[model samples]
Target: MMDVGRHPNIKLLAYSEIESISGYIGNFHVRVRKKARYVDETQCTACGECAKVCPVAVPDEYQLGLSLRKAIYIPFAQAVPSAYLIDMKACLGTNPIACGKCAEKCDKKCINYDMQDEIIEFDAGVVIVATGMDVYDPTELEEYGYTRYENVITSMEFERLISAGGPSDGHFIRPSDKRRPKTVGFIQCVGSRSERRGKPYCSNICCMNTVKDTLLLKDHYPDVEAKVFYIDIRAFGKGFEDLFKRSKEAGVQYIRGIPGEIIEDPVTKNLKVMVEDTTTNRISEHELDMIVLSVGVTPRADMPEVQQLLTLSKTPDGFFMEAHPKLKPVDAPTSGVFFAGCAEAPKDVKDSVTQASAAASRAMTVLSAGKIKLEAITSVINPEICRFCTICAQACPYKAIKVEPKKKSIELIEAMCKGCGTCGAECRFGAIKMRHFTDEQTYAQIDAYLEEDPYNKIIVFACNWCSYAGADTCGGARLQYPPSARLIRTMCSGRVDEDWVLYAFRKGAPIVVVSGCHFVDCHYIDANRWTQKRVEKLWDKLEKLGIRPDRLFLEWISAAEGQRFAKTMIDIERHRQRVTKEEIEYTMKVLSEQK
Candidate 1:
């Protein structure tokens, strides 16, 4: 980030946050809230004279609470702009008139306590989101004794303690006693790969990081004993396995198991970890001078806020979702925005840098092009049919539908829309229609299929990308299934309007199946989630209308699941046969009457 900030082409704005993001690719308007620094960056020389005489002292966050810093100080040694910033929240001058000594001592007179936060706006062709990640606070896991024991530290704190510029000047000493430790224990997966407390996905860096730390410890003190407890060691990266072997050769004992509890001795403040070694089939306890929790990475707590701000989607793991994980790894569902670093998933420094560079390249691709070409599959609002209810805008997940209040109509932004057809499906007034799959075209297909034996046949609405492809694969594989099933392909399951489902039942179709990509695997990224919710609501409506909810089925059929697709069709056909013609006719009558 410091390197990016140093780039001459990049206008790095420090202490700024995105307030609002509006517009589409090749033309985005962004509003940033520039926080007050309280010091003039152009005049401040960064000399320590003002800080040396400053009276107010506070805990230095850069040192991880291991050292003290003046109220007016640089955030870190290599901070950009090299300007002193006043901690207004802690500064005495901001609260009371007790301190102005720093300002009095400054020869350049750069200090100013009256500066207010400023808002700035800019136009950008593209955006790269590299929000990074936050380490899980092991203090939440009380079993680890993190906050209770001074000797128990997080992996981040351990990094700083072992850093050359860190407090104690690169010396590895226990926080409680400030003495060199003879034995050290590292607990792996403190906040990772656990359903009970932390996340389920592997943090991808903890195993190698522990190895790095162990090597660093061995280099510093050859005689010091280092033991690591892990469920499994993941050495998948380039040269990572060699580093793991080096750590093992350096006398770092690798134990395969997670520690159940960490108890501390009151006398020496030593941490005692209890674990059952899966390798030796024996339970053991180890007392160490310091215990470092190899905590995992989690999506930022404010991730939802950012998602809402940028109108982005999140994966089940809470990280920002990419448009296509393989082909478009750095691109978000929103065209203009791209993802980088741990914002997409847990990654190491190398992976983060690589992804960050990829995101930069992807953003540059858009900026280099004067304009972006959009797909014609976007939805269009029919002003003549519109009721000005604004339901389409509310239903639009991408925020692509705009309600023109004065004109009393709705407008669709083609570039912004991903062609999910959620707006068209949610509009009760028939105001919205998706391109290539209009209301007339979709209903015409239903009419044509039902013209022969609509009452005896089953109507299936399948998403084009997944369920429809699955059906095609099932046919190509020669999987035997009921011939009565007729499939209609749409861009997404979200495009399957509730009215279409009811129309099938009204036309005397014995069964109606709505299928799409599996949850978390939607091509549109979470569009199937909306399909699931819609189907659940329709189930309640079916029950109220005296129709057996069993007649209406919703299944997730992936593109690769050919056998499952054929089996599902066979199962639905068999179930449909059980429903007598009288029952089917009765349900059809009820649906028609309701319509």
Candidate 2:
């Protein structure tokens, strides 16, 4: 990152937060709040003379609060800019007027207490999000005894203890008495792969990290006993399995079970871990001087803030969602914004670096072109037909519809619009229209299906990726279903708006079924969840309007579930037969008049 920061083409802007983002992909106007660093980067030489004279000391976050740092100090040894930054929160001038010795001792006089935050605006052709991840806190799992026992420490704290510049100067010692330990226990998956406390996804680095830490211990202390408790050793990467094997060959004991509890010894301040070996079917207890909890990685705490800022969608696990996991892994649903590293999902260091490189290449592909070609399926607003009600603006999920209050007109940004037709469906005045799937195209399909045998037909709106594919799978498998069904495919279930559902009823269709991917496994991230919510609202409205809610159904059918899809359609057809022609006619008349 420091090397990239030194690139002449890339003007590095540090200590900045994005305040606002406007416009669309190719010509985005971004406003950034450049926070004050209070030191001149160009003038200061990163010498340690100023830091030595500073009296104010605070816990160093880079060392995981295991060490102290001067008020005016560098973040770390390899920190970019290689310059001192004043800790305004800890500095005497900002907190209180107790001391100003650091400012007085600086030879270059770079310290400035009066600097204020400045806002700057810039045009970006592309944006890459690589905010990375945070370690899960094990304090909530009280059974681990993390907060109570000084011998129990997280993997991050252990990393610092093994580093040369760490608090104890790379000496592995017990936190209670600073004595060398003969036995250490590594507990794997402390907050991973468990639905009870933390996330369910496998944190990709924990297994390898434990292996690396065990190797580090063996290098420093040859006779020290190291044991690792894991459900299964996941060493899938290149040379990773070799490292795992090497650790075992070097006499590190591998246990096949996570410890249930860690009890502290009263006399020696050691830890006694209780575990049941699944292979041997035996419960065992081990005494260890130090216990390192191999914590899992989770999405950043401010992920929701970033999601709103970029208008990006998130998966059920709260990590940023990719446009397509296999096809467009780095790209976000919003075209220009891309994801890298653990921000997308849990990944190892090698995967992170690979993804970072891929993200850089993807961003360069957009910026190097100097212009972007938008998809043909974007939304369009007709100025002459627009009523200027601003309903489209309110309904658009991507904020693609822009209304000019001064002109009293609405404009659709082609780059930002996803062609979901949600705005067109919500617009009461029929002002907005999607390009490929326009109102006329949709109505034509409905007219074709319902023009003949309208009262007996069952209308099904299936999403392209999942439900539609499921229908194909049913046909390929020769699954038996009713022939009275008519299908219309959309890009996603979210595209099946409320007006469309009501419109099907108005066309004399006895039953209307909206189907898509299952929740959390949506092709468009959480789009299916929105579809679920809309269907529920429609059911409520039907019940309130004295219409039978059973006439409408919402089902989640994955592409692999051919038998289930065939059974669902057959079952719905059986129910549709219960509605007589007179009841269908009466319902259609009432719905049409109401619309």
Candidate 3:
């Protein structure tokens, strides 16, 4: 961090926020709002003269409120630029007449009460999101006694209490009395792996973090007793298992059970925990001087803003979704954006560092190439026929389409397009045509598939990423359902044009199924959502035309689900068998008339 701050080429914009983001890959225009620090960073030295005179004391958030800092202070010990910043909210100089002791005391005269926020604009080729994560606060968990008892603090507070620069000056102590505790209790997964109270995902670092803390305690004070309460210990990382073993060997007791409740003695300020040992099937109470709630990591508070600005997708856990879990773990579905650290998922320190390096390399490669490569599977807008209604623009998941209503113009950014063909499918008029998976090619595939005994065949429009791959997986697994199903592949389910479905039905097909990735897990971001809308519209149209809506089946199938693909095919076959030849002919005639 210090090296980056001093680097000639790197301009470190600390205490700044992204106000707005525009443009696309290799040509991005970004506006940043740099918050006022009230101190000239270039002139002010790291001397503690100004902080010593400031009267107002604020809770140090970096120390998890275990210590107090002056209103004018550096964020942390090794803060980049090594300058003190006045918190406007807490600083008395905000109302200049009240007080300005920091400005008066500064030997360099760098403090300025009239400092205003500055907005800066710049261009960048690629952006990497490494906003990191926030730790879950355990104050709501009354059973843990985090708020009621002073000694029942969080693991972060414990870290501050044990640190050399902490309030206790490297002496571990209870918050109530400021005296070192003989017995300490560590509770793992305080805000994780709980469907009711907290997040259902494992925190990924809590178990190992607790082990390290216990090891630290034993190394400093061997006589101090440390007991860890956890459902299970995950020591899967390199050298992590050895550290867990060392902690156990150092007399740290590991109990395979989550403590149900903590009761603190009002007079002594000691805590009593109730937990059931799953190994022995016994319930017992343990006494401790202090209890540390090992809180889980959660998505940053500003995650929503980041998601909106970057057009990024999020996972079920609320972290930014990667393009692919295995193949492109660090890359965002948005072409030029990448993710690092816990912004993508709850990763450990080493994993975060590794991802950061990979993101840098990816960004360098994109910049070095000077231009982004456009895939062949992008949508092309026919200006002559385009009504410029902006439906295509609205439906585009990547925001690749730009529509000008006044000028009656629509533009497509080829570099930004992910080839989902959502815009083409959403176009009411035949203005936007998807390359590779054109209307003509898709119609031909559907027509040919239903040419011979169409009533017996269930035509399936499967997405290339998920449903189509699922069929291949089914075949590889030797899973048999029925050969009556004929699959037609599109880049995305969103690429399945309504005309293609109408054409299939008019060709005398009994059942037509459209399948793709699940709504939230669309490989092309929200392309599958457009697919759902298109299918619903088709269903309504079919019903209005006196055709059975049930004849059109909509299913979401992932690539790994071979069994599900086979089951879905079997279900379609069963539905097809129920549709009599007379009903098929009637539906075919109705669709033909509608077309």
Top candidate on lDDT is 3
TM-score against truth, every candidate: 0.95, 0.95, 0.98
lDDT (CA) per prediction: 0.87, 0.86, 0.91
lDDT of 3 by residue, 1-595 (tens): 9999989989999999999898889888899999999999999997989999899999998887778999999999999989999998898884655788888888899998888999999999899999999999898898887878999988888888899988788998898898889999999998899999889999999999999999999999999999999999999989999999999999999988988889889899999988899999999899999999999999998999999998998888899999998989889999889888999999899999999999999888888988777888899999999998999999888888889999987799999998999888888889998888898898888778877888899899999999999999999999997999999999999988888888888899899999999866799888888888889999998898888899999999999899999999998899899999998889877766666
Across 505-538, the per-residue lDDT of candidate 1 in tens digits comes to 8777889999998877787756677788889999
By the TM-score metric, which is better: model 2 or model 3? 3
By summed lDDT, the worst window of 10 consecutive residues in model 1 runs over 89-98
CA-only RMSD, every prediction: 2.0, 2.1, 1.2
Runs in model 3 lying further than 4 Å from the true structure: 94-96
Distance from true location, Cα of 77 in model 3, Å: 0.8
For model 1, the stretches where C-alpha displacement exceeds 4 angstroms are 1-3, 473-480, 540-545, 590-595
Worst 10 residues of 2 by lDDT: 520-529
Better of 1 and 3 by TM-score: 3
Error of 2 at 4 (Å): 2.0
The lDDT-based order of candidates, best leading, equals 3, 1, 2
Best by TM-score: 3
- Give candidate 2 regions above 4 Å deviation: 94-98, 405-407, 519-534, 592-595
Model 2 lDDT, residue 375, Cα:
72
